[model samples]
Target: MSAADGSASAADGSVNALTSALWERRPQTSVRIVDAHAHVGPYSLFFIPDAGSDGMVRVMDRCGVSHAVISSHLAIQLDAAAGNAATAEVVGRAPDRFTGYLTVNPWQDPARELGMWGSDHRFGGIKLHPDLHDYPLTGGRYAPVWEFAQRTGCPVLTHTYDGSPYNDLPMVDEVAARYPDVAILAGHAGATPNGFDAAIEVARRRPGVVLEVCGSFNSGSDIARMVREVGADRVVYGSDFPFIDLRMSLGRVIFSGLTEEDRAAVLGGTMTRLLQWRSGRE
Candidate 1:
């Protein structure tokens, strides 16, 4: 049986079970990985219990991943408050190695509750899984969450793509258009069944909106296309870790044929600046 956090699995049921082409490449990205889209440990990689918090830190160290942002899948499935609190606790053990993203309920008293969560130091920003949360990003009820983030100078990370508009893109784009400074991160980088075009469009149209390197990968040509269409600064590295391998995912970025500067930005520099901004808030 697989434990949620990716601990002690049998050779048959490894983390690589559902991995992709990059997983097969086992490409050596070599650069220090900054997993922007990973879920923290202790919540199992897939939201099962007993994933163990230490698993995150240990695996990160093993893979040369310098840092990661942990979001609670629990909040996505169950209690938002508990999810946020649990995610915070995981990051607390190794603050230097992990960044916490507070998972909030899009359907909850988003305005009042989100405003109230501003002081949680563990949270660098907000994470929204519109598809999983069952809320519309463009819906008026969600505006308060974006507005508050803009006011507080924090970014919001949301799942966005070609499909799942109600859960992902249109609303993300709408909210992003509303608050340019909020730094909305378009999760998945539109990386799935042919979403690159839309991901590219968002990068072109939205100045502060960036594509996160998560449950997504690009063909060599696709990677080149991404850079040509959106420019490299709009790109950021992320690993949907525990769910994927740091080495493999980082390899996708490192090998994606972008300029050295662009590679630096995507590898970790761009996010490094974002983290510095977050530090001032603390």
Candidate 2:
């Protein structure tokens, strides 16, 4: 794919030129195409052996993704502080291209971890995985995270899936209602196209709730619907990289049939503003 035309010349996963041009033109509109959700390290669950920050950067360069907000497997799967430190180290190496979301488990000294990680400029937000942590979103133990977000005006991206007893949108909505000042990003927005509407409804009911679209499979039409129902500002793009292909994830946004301005907001503008809630940290 060359910039002269937007055609995919081959299926080698290379970005076509027209696609490149579209992303390249984003800065003129004062928005960067930022991936709001992503992860690094060896994921033991899915058996992904290894994918680090360097590999992530290579994919971003090819796909015209200006930056990515990332968490680490250590944080999500193993230990929060270790994963956060690993992520911070990676971001420290390429501060211009990467930012971090420090992962924290509710049961693990939540307040101390939140304070320790949140104070670092390299980390712009927080990431939570209730499924991995085996906790409910509204559980009392998780109160510190919500309180921290509310007080600091930081964004929290939590793993959410609709139709599940755990990690569903309704649970996220309950937390959002309690902390109106905190911005909550619903991870994957339901985990598939079918869950989009439920996630959209959550965002509709709570203005502070935002949808992070980053599942293994999502449809372009679903993305358009999200923009329409929740408005583009409430929807953000995230490629669950290494776990999923980044190029394919970028394609969803490019072909979602969104207006340029709305696309810009979904791609990066909204996240930029959300991260900025911490006094322009990212």
Q: Which has the greatest lDDT?
A: 2
The collision pairs in model 2 are: 1-17, 2-17, 3-17
**TM-score, per-candidate, Cα-based:** 0.81, 0.87
Off by over 4 Å in 2: 1-31, 280-282
Clashes of 1: 5
Residue-level lDDT of model 1, residues 1-282, one tens digit each, is: 448444434322322332233455433243445777777543333443335557766666655568888787676556677777788888887888888887777776666557666677777778887777677778777777777777777777787756784655556667777787878888877767467777777778888887786664555456656667776667778776665655567667666766656766777777766655556665
- 146: Cα error in model 1, Å: 0.8
**Model 1 ranges off by over 4 Å:** 1-32, 41-50
For model 2, residues 103-137, the per-residue Cα lDDT tens digits are 88876777778778778988888999998888888
In model 1, what is the error at residue 132, expressed in angstroms? 0.5
